[model samples]
Target chain A: MRFYAVAVYGFLYLPIAIIALFSFSAGRSASSMDGFSTGWYVRALSNPFVMEALWTSLKVAFFSAVLATVSGTMAALALTGMKGRLRAIFDVLVMIAVMIPGVVIGIAALIALATAFSAINPWLEVVLGRQLSMGLGTLIGLHGMFTMSLVVLLVRGRLETFDRAQIEASNDLGASPLGTFLQVTLPQIAPAILAGFLLAFTFSFDDFIMAFFVAGSETTLPIYIFSSIRRGVTPEINAIGTMVMVASLTLLIIAQILLRTGTLRAKG
Target chain B: MAITQARARALLLTPAGLWYAALLLFPLAVVLIFSFGERNPIGGYAPGFTLEQYANLPARFAAFRNTLTLAPLGTVAALLIAYPLAYYLAIKVSVRWKTTLLILVIVPFWTSILIRSYAWIYLLGGNGIPALLEAFGLGELRLINTPFAVLVGIVYGYLPLMVFPIYVALEKLDKSLLEAASDLGAPPWRSFLQITLPMSMPGVMTGSMLVFILLTGEFLIPAILGGGKVFFVGNALVDLFLQSRNWAFGSAVAVALIVIMLIVVALYTRAVRRFGVRRDDVGLM
Candidate 1:
């Protein structure tokens, strides 16, 4: 069993380790492990398109995470406190949002946004003096909603063990609702919220399918990677892939740390 | 003041509610409606109610066939590999090593599947694994752009998804029960079959469902690893919507995918309930 676990772990990291190792390779492709060089890394870093796509992904991730975290936090708070069938409805909505395959969501988003923009674009041109269909804003909006379920789930996990007496104590001490939330409610659940934010950010940043549909002409990192791969594989792409792999892993580690500590300390 | 409490709760919930309705429900409704519509002259959806889109399902029968076979096959493949790893991690690992090992399991999951698939291209491509095999006298092999390559990628990609749930289920298994079985002269293998396997069914079911559903819509793996040769419904949807611009047909495909998923999930839920093991394991799915 122990040997099996080690092998499984090896299998898990095989591709990632290969990509990272080959990223610094002097070899043209992965087959030859020819002595190492930083050429591919340098090229991937300097490539203008890579930079732009990374920037676009970072922007989308940042805004979507922010939107999902805030909205999900509110929804989580409301859900933890509320009771009734409305909660069930919202619960199903979250499940449906998550359960719907990325392809389905992609097409659905395409239809919904396309019709909305077509219907509204003419009116916008008449009123606001310009026509804008799908763009970065729509992409961000769709991504934000797409990842909101993760945010809510994380927050609600923390809320499941949430101590109610703290809130009651805050209210009993004459703290305003806002003050209670900021000082009392927020501090403990802060870890979960931050975790949610980071996760949603990673999910949005890594998204390919949904973004491919609603992206319009704005290329995010994954889409850029997809096009580049379609053209042909190169060591530079491996370099980019390695960089992204490292970045997301770091975020995930930080999130896990937050989760573990949050559960332990928030037990108070 | 009474109304303010209700109003405050509503205020908190409204954003999420409205967001789901707008982004999730509304889009799905659009897909459902568009499924019955006609593809216009230029390719996008046209305004007409018709079963013609449904009639055209056979056009992508190849894709549907590939997806149906591969989704289940891949799920089984992932489960076969994942179950043993998860069993070891849950049953055998010491606490000192468990956290590190578990974290390692999840590390790859955090990275983009695209990046992982890209790496596989090199690993499975002519200049990679197959080349090594050929040099080693395994004979010339064409692993790249094949169903086998796609399956490899699927199992690699979904390993963690299947592993964790089973780990959770196995960890939750009461160890003393196994001891109880063993002390009664039952062999370890029999105990495992009688106690551990049955106890872990929920996790297995959950993991399989997760892998199966995701695989059904999988595009990136087959696209990246299959090298445009293999086709799944996801590839079909991508072509229908992105390449062909056939909104009505694409929506019909999407609806078909959903109905298939619904049937599978519905049957899975029934199985889980029948086993009386249904729990928050379903929630994770």
Candidate 2:
């Protein structure tokens, strides 16, 4: 068992170790490890397209995270107060949203967005003097839609354990609903909110399929990585991939720490 | 006063309900509507209704065939590889080492799969693993762009997903039960088969479902590792929608995929519940 476990760890890290090792290689072919150099990293960073995609990913994740948090927090609260059949339907809907293949979602969104734009094309042309279609906004909306469930699950789990008396006390002192939520509920569940945002951001940043469909010509990081891989393998992509791996791992570590020690949970 | 209470509840639901409907339901409705329509000559859907798209399903039979077989095979492969590691961590590791090791398991999981798959591309490429094998007099072996490579990539990408759930189940198991089983004439292996494996059924089911479901939709591994020769439904759908721009046929495929996903998930839930092991908290992806 000990040997097997060590072997499993080796398997997990083997490719990662290789990629990191090769990213510093002076050679272009990833299979060959030549003299070490930082040329690939410089090339990856200097590439304007890589920078653009990175910026787009960050912007999309930030916006989607905020939207998902707000909507999900509200939904979680509403779900708690819901009764019987309505709550069951909402529950199933959320499950379906997550369970359905992302490709299905992507196609549906693509078709839907195209149809929507066609219907509004005349109006759009009248207003903006051109037809509009899917872009970063659509990507953000899709990410927010799919990731809302994670927020609901996290925030609702926290809310279930939350003390009701504190909220009642705020209400007992004649606080408005907004006031009561802000003063009593929000602060207590802030950690769950933070965790949800982080999860949403992670999903958004790492997303590829849905982004691939809706992102139009404005490439996001995953799409860019994918297209580059398709066009031809490059050592510079390995460098970029290494940097992305490091960044996401760092975010996840921060998320684990936040969720583990804070009100939200790392484990289910 | 009663109206006010109802109104407050309605207000709270408005944003989420709207978001769900516009994003999920509306798109779903559009796809369903398009599934019955015809594909236009210029690409995308036309207004005419027909069952031709459903009948045309067999056109991508190879993709569906590959998906059905590989998804389960990949799940089993992941399960076989992950079980022992999860067992070691949960049952054998010291408390101090457990945290660091588990974190290591997850850090890679959170990294972009694109990066991970890219790594595999090079490893399985000409001068990578094959070269190593050549050094050992194994002859020049072809690993890249094969089903073997796809399976390896699948197992590698999903190992952590399979591990964590099993680890959680094993971690929470009653050691006293195992000890009691062992206190009797039964050996450690027997005790494990009876107590540990049966008790960890939820994790196994959850992990298998999560991996299997995702694997069914996967295109990236096949695209990168299989070199576009090996295809799944996801790859087919990507081509139908993006390349062909065949919206009606794409919608039909999309609807079929959803139905298949729903049926499989439902069947899995029923099977799990039929066994009286309903552990829904598999830490949903």
Candidate 3:
């Protein structure tokens, strides 16, 4: 069992380790590590295309995370007051949102947006003399809505363990509902919401399929990587990959620490 | 005040409710409606109603076939490898290092699957594994751009998704049940077969469903690793919409894929219910 576990861990991490190690290669070939150098990292950073895509990805991730966190938290909070059939329907919708494949979401969103654009672009042209097209806005909207389900799940999970007595106590003391929520509920769910936001951001930053479909003329980092890699793997691509790996892993670690400490504090 | 509270609840739900209605429900409804429409001469959809796209579903049957076969295979392969690792982590690992070990399991997952699949391309390409094998007198062999390579990428990409659910299930499992079973003179293996496996079925189901559903719409793995040979429904959808601009047919494929996913979820739900697992226990997120 121990050997099997070790092997599985190796399987999971070896490719990632290889990517990280080879990213600093002085050689141009991705398959071989000629010597240690940060040239690829420098080159990747200086490349205008990579930087532009990275900036777009960051913008999309930031906006989507904020949107998802706020809206999903609100939905989760409201769902607490719901029950019976209405709650059940909402639960199904959220679950379906999460369960639907990224590809399907992409295609569905593409068609939906296309249909919407055709119907709305004419009106916009008559008024603003311009048209709405898919780009950063679409990417942010798609990622935010999709990831909102995740936020809802996380906050709802936290709410399950939440002590309702605190809210009642605040109410009994003549505290306003808003005051009680601000003082009690927000603190309790803050960790989950933050964790959800980090996850949402990570997902948006790393996403390719849905972005590929609806990004229109815009490019995301993952989409950039996909296209560049299709040309052929390079140390530069490896450098970008390593950077993404490091960035997301760091975020994940922070989120993990937050969740663990949050639970510990709650228990204490 | 009561009316205000009701209004506040409505206000809270409005954004998410509208978001879902617009992005989620409306999009899906559009796909359904468009699937029945006809493709124009120029490629995109036209307003005419027709069953032509549905009838033409067999045009991309190979893509559907490959996805159905490989997605299940990938799920089962991931499950086989993941179950033991999850078992070791939950059952064998000491508490002192459990969190670190668990986090290590997820570290790779935090990275983009696209980047991870890129790494696999080099590893399975001529100079990586094949080179090593040649040094050992195994001779030359093709690995990249094959179905085998795609399977490897799928398993590698989805391992954490598979691992976590089973780990959560095992972690939540009552160890006392195993002790009681042993106290009744059941062998260790017997106790495991009776207690551990059944209890973790929900996790197994959840992980499998997640992987399977995602794999059905998988585009990146087969695209990056399969090198255009191993087509999936997702690839077909991408080609239809992005490349060919066949919106109607793409919508049909999308509709088909959703129906298949719905069926898988329904079956999984039934199985979970049969095992008497609470719906909440099978965490999708």
DockQ for every model, please.
0.80, 0.72, 0.80
lDDT of 3 by residue, A137-239 (tens): 8999999999999999998888877889989999999998889999999998899899999999999999998898889999999999999988998899999
Here, model 3's chain A TM-score works out at 0.98
Q: List ranges where model 2 is wrong by over 4 Å.
A: A127-130, A169-176, A264-268, B1-5, B277-285
lDDT for A155 (candidate 2) = 88
- Chain A TM-scores of each predicted structure, in the order given, are 0.96, 0.91, 0.98
Q: Candidate 1: lDDT of A211? A: 93
Per-residue C-alpha lDDT of model 2 across residues A59-144, encoded as one tens digit per residue = 99999999999999888888875777868978988887888778788888889888998999999899989988788889989999
Candidate 3 pairs with clashing backbones:
none
> B1-285 in candidate 3: lDDT tens per residue?
878877887899899999999888999998999899988889888987899999999999999999999999999999999999999999999999898899889888888899888888878998889999999999899999999999999999998999999999899988887878888999999978878888888899999988898888799999999999988898898899889999999999888998998899889889888876543342321
TM-score of each: 0.96, 0.94, 0.96
| Docking level of model 2 | medium
TM-score of model 3 vs. true structure: 0.96
Q: Which stretches of candidate 3 lie over 4 Å from their true place?
A: B277-285
